[model samples]
Target: MITKWEVLSLIWASGVAYTAPRILNRWSLITTCDPIELCQGCRDERRYVMQEGMTYEVMGAAGGPLQVLVEAFAWYLKPFLPALRRAAGRPPLPTCSKGSCLAHTSTRRRA
Candidate 1:
């Protein structure tokens, strides 16, 4: 016989099991960037991180994992996104430049 407590515990565990990895996968986007100063690379990473959250929130367990996987895979090809867009007949986004701006410094860094 299944007691009420056991049923509740199963539900709670299931929720945690589903959410825990999604949360960690989303957090993987955090890279080198000071809390106050976000480099262009930081901005892109953060944007993708937020997209992960939104994707999971909207898609739920059904589609979220696959969509997030696609997104994560896309991050590996960041250098090619500009060319991909250009080939698609879209104007390049301004942040596609080779060097990332760190804070307000004259030195532009990162790929």
Candidate 2:
């Protein structure tokens, strides 16, 4: 029952209905290509101020006198601890190859 002009009009209307929203919703449709230039002055300065304050607090706590002294003492004693342990006749540290690997491999083979 449709005539030629009516069919062409219907096709044009359907095409517009399908593509209009997609064109409108595109990222470039609503936003500027030079976004950084537009937004450069809109950033919140409070966040930067708070971050600097927290950095100063953390640095003060980590480098306090007692912390510095403890770190220095540990560094000084690092080389002597192994020799002292041997002289005390404590058993040498356990080897992972002897204990962990043997147990896991034995269980896997049995299974």
Candidate 3:
């Protein structure tokens, strides 16, 4: 009942189905890779570290006014880092539509 020809045909069909869209899609190359790391928590931690470093440079006055402004913005983003860590199951840098970041404020207080 199970012939090599049938098995080969099935495998070839599945392969085509799986890869067809990738090959046929006009904008296949337009899709961009995510900058954030694999885990959401790890990505958040990275963001926090970068922000903290920027803030330190700004406070130390090592950079100009524009740099200071950018640093200040980085600092302002700190409070949302924990939430980003929690929402890691989703995209590495998920959009803040679910207010997951607000939930994290309380979680951070406990830790």
Candidate 4:
């Protein structure tokens, strides 16, 4: 049989555990800037490092694995995102269905 205090404690603990990641991630984003704008060939690398660091810190504080596999997969893809974005010329977003949108989508979707 669980006491009221234990139930309350568990609720609070779960809330903190759930909310902690969002708080930490927001803080991490606030602390870091776009690497490309700050450093040459460094944005992707820096972003990855920051992401890894942030994940490590949050997981460490949470005292449990929090989306570790997902984060790790994301980290693996981090380095390629910028390149992927740039390889197609770093085109602007599809505000309208223009050539840029089609070109970007087709290129990426191609085998």
lDDT of model 4 at position 42: 35
- Give per-candidate clash totals: 0, 0, 0, 0
How do the predictions measure up, each by TM-score?
0.38, 0.27, 0.24, 0.31
Please state the error at residue 52 of candidate 4 in Å.
22
Q: What is the lDDT of residue 28 in candidate 4?
A: 46
lDDT of 4 by residue, 41-66 (tens): 23443455466666678557553345
* Over 4 Å off, model 4: 34-111
Best of the two (1, 3) by TM-score: 1
lDDT of 2 by residue, 24-68 (tens): 332222132233322222112223323444555666765343332
lDDT ranking, high to low: 1, 4, 3, 2
lDDT of 1 at 49: 63
lDDT of candidate 2 vs native?
0.42
For model 3, give the RMSD to the true fold. Answer: 19.2
lDDT of each: 0.55, 0.42, 0.44, 0.48
In angstroms, what RMSD does candidate 2 have relative to the true structure? 31.9
Question: Compared to the true structure, candidate 3 yields what TM-score?
Answer: 0.24
Error of 1 at 68 (Å): 3.5
Model 1 stretches with alpha carbons more than 4 Å out: 1-35, 59-64, 72-80, 89-111
Regions of candidate 2 where Cα sits further than 4 Å from its true position: 27-34, 37-111
Best by TM-score: 1
